[model samples]
Target: MISLPLLSHAISSCNGPCRDLNDCDGQLICINGKCNDDPDVGTHICGKNPPPPPSGGRGSGCSQYGTLTCGGSAYPTYKCSPPVTSSTAAKLTNNDFSEGGDGGGPSSCDGKYHSNSERIVALSTGWFANSSRCGKMIKITAKNGRSVMAKVVDECDSMQGCDAEHAYQPPCKNNIVDGSDAVWSALGLDKNVGIVGVTWSMA
Candidate 1:
């Protein structure tokens, strides 16, 4: 958070809105004679915060069912409407990431986007391993004044339209993308296949 200027010398200093002031306006509480309000993170109203209700897709965006690895991260750019056929027609307990994974034994969240250093430093050492990125749930927007909630745990590699089998799941299942479907469906992608600006707050 940046500091706002104060009207230290403005008590009886500058006559009016004369000069010396950069972009101050109105009567906010000026500092050093300048005024300011606050900075906005990124606001967008989407559909639902918990999204499709909590029963569906809670941590899929966290890290592929629940691993906390980059393998589960998704940065969707949803469509203006619902998905198409062969599109994401299923919910959580039935998605790709929901499939059995490696020897991880299933965690509650699948890594979405990450703040690696946060988790890595907290690790004890040889317990499991240190994976970069640590995704947390974030609120985003879609249609109208709706807010969609999604997760971001790991760093994505920018690869779309492909599938990666789970190396340890026997039928080895996990978040494997055949196209942008999973990503698109999960985040309710925008018209363009790109990333959306979501305001994240831990739930």
Candidate 2:
């Protein structure tokens, strides 16, 4: 496992608001006006410092989990309420990222090749559209309480999706994430579609 060294400054140092990505530390980015750490191999997959619980979802249930608070009030522009903690609220799908008739073939955002052993995810176009999220890390917690940290390796597009301007189609609704076989196994999910309550956050 790879271990990441700590930043000279704590993550909270940059928690203050910022308007530009350049305003935050080189390893951090500005999201929602706050400087935050860019989830990486050390914090997520390396078993070093794990992130907090879900706090950015639907009800107060979200706050009990991660650092970010969830709820309609927490996110003014959010599309839908975040699911309750460990509830089967988020829907999970699967994809092979295979070549040929699989349509888009290899990863559309980055050309990097990810084998099944890698814990990778094909995020919805809405999220994948931001190329900056390409190599970052995301923490995915399943309803069963099994969680895994995965890399943003590819894009998950539905009908009329995966364009340079946009990453998904309207039909993708609710299904914002599609994991590789390795991801499915890591979360203790079955090979088929898994209706899981997922809580994720950047490291």
Candidate 3:
């Protein structure tokens, strides 16, 4: 098993020299010590330092998270997401997972649509980690002092989007937790608010 020291070494090697996934070009991901086009390698081989939160609206303090243009609209997207913390910070956004819903298609993990009343979520690409967290339960805590348990059902793509599969929506941010209506209601948050700050952890 890889130790913390080895993980740290991998991260430093990626940033200082050219050894890990960050140094790879194109769709290749790091596995062991070589770059390969295997999605199953997962993303835990390297640690990503969190970029400071954007202080203003679009285009402000968004250099870390690059931009993508889709349907005449530019969206901010991240190549790398923040490392998980004790209470990993994230942005909770509304999502519809039922058939013919705004979530686009069947869930990535199970390939089935879930009801809005189900406490399910679609995590950002990095956290999704090639479906590594599929079917897992997580605890989400909102600022309103409410919390709920949600199951991981899909991935909110952070790398690529603006396609039919993605419902032409822009790529998701690296720290997003796209939750269903039940999650919001359980947290005592109004879905009309759209997005809100929250923290979560594996349950």
Root-mean-square deviation per candidate: 19.5, 14.5, 11.0
TM per prediction: 0.21, 0.48, 0.68
- For candidate 1, lDDT tens digit of each residue in 32-112? 543432112111211123123224334332212111113344232221112222222221111222234321222223533
Cα-lDDT of candidate 1: 0.27
| Span of 10 residues, lowest total lDDT, candidate 1 | 120-129
Per-residue lDDT of candidate 3, residues 1-203 (tens digit):
74433444343232233356554432345556555443442222234543455665343322344445557766666655677766988999999999988888899999999999999999998889889999999999999888999999999998767767788788998889999999999999999999999999999
Instruction: Return the lDDT, model 1, position 134.
Output: 34
Give the top-scoring candidate (TM-score). Answer: 3
Which runs in model 2 stand beyond 4 Å of their true positions? 1-89, 100-103, 158-171
Local distance difference test scores for all models:
0.27, 0.52, 0.77
Which run of 10 residues does model 3 get worst, by summed lDDT?
9-18
Ranking by TM-score: 3, 2, 1
Q: Report the alpha-carbon TM-score of model 2 versus the true structure.
A: 0.48
Residue ranges of candidate 3 with Cα displaced over 4 Å: 1-66
For candidate 3, what is the lDDT?
0.77
